[model samples]
Target: MSTVACPDCEARVSLDTPVLNEIVECAECRSELEVLSTDPVVLGRAPEVEEDWGE
Candidate 1:
């Protein structure tokens, strides 16, 4: 298992074979986290999903 610190809460999150662009949730803050990289296991805040009005 790989451990990485949550960018929002600074809590340790364990990942099992995490991949790039994978979305994960933080247990402490419950914020969505995105996998920026996998080599060193870097994590960042996930972008909020917005709906398009067929524009």
Candidate 2:
């Protein structure tokens, strides 16, 4: 998980969550924070396809 400190309230925000495109309130300053994108978002390499021919 990743955390980004809020510029307004300096709160540690986790960027590794699945919930994106949402608004969150700051615990300290009570400021509204818009969740932009989740962290650790990536695409895995394609797996090799095996042949169906019987050996």
Candidate 3:
């Protein structure tokens, strides 16, 4: 997941890769956020996981 800040509305937005090339409006302040760069975005979350995905 990735988090981006809206300069227009100063909203903290969170999204995944699919939302990468998308222009979404900030729900908080209704500002347009254009994902300018295709570079993968990363949030400052923990870099580790505990559970396995093979269920």
Candidate 4:
């Protein structure tokens, strides 16, 4: 497990074998976060999720 700081709340979050481009929810601020890097465990705010309309 690796500890990372949440971008939204700066809260330390623990992740296990985090993969790049994976989305994770912050437990502190409840913000969606994306795993940018796994080497050092870097997190960034995830992009807004939009509903897809049936084409």
- Among these predictions, the greatest TM-score belongs to 1
lDDT of 3 at 18: 31
- Which tens-of-lDDT digit does each residue in 3-50 have in candidate 1? 999998799999999999999999999999999999989999999999
Per-candidate TM-score against the hidden true structure: 0.95, 0.49, 0.54, 0.84
Best by lDDT: 1
Residue-wise lDDT of candidate 3 within 1-55, one digit each (tens)? 6777766655687776634446666678766566666465422222233688787
Once fitted onto the true fold, the runs of candidate 4 whose alpha carbons sit more than 4 angstroms away are 51-55
Evaluated against the true structure, the overall lDDT of model 2 is 0.55
Question: Candidate 2 regions off by >4 Å?
Answer: 14-18, 40-55
The alpha-carbon lDDT assigned to residue 17 of candidate 1 equals 94
lDDT score of residue 15 within candidate 1: 96
lDDT of 4 by residue, 1-55 (tens): 8988898888988888899999998888899899998887889988897888965
Looking at model 3, residue 45 earns an lDDT score of 24
Listed per model in order, the count of residue pairs whose N, CA or C atoms clash below 3 Å is 0, 1, 0, 0
Quantify all predictions' global Cα lDDT against the true fold: 0.95, 0.55, 0.58, 0.89
Ten residues in sequence with the least summed lDDT for candidate 1: 1-10
**Residue 3 local lDDT, model 3:** 74
Model 3 per-residue lDDT at 38: 49
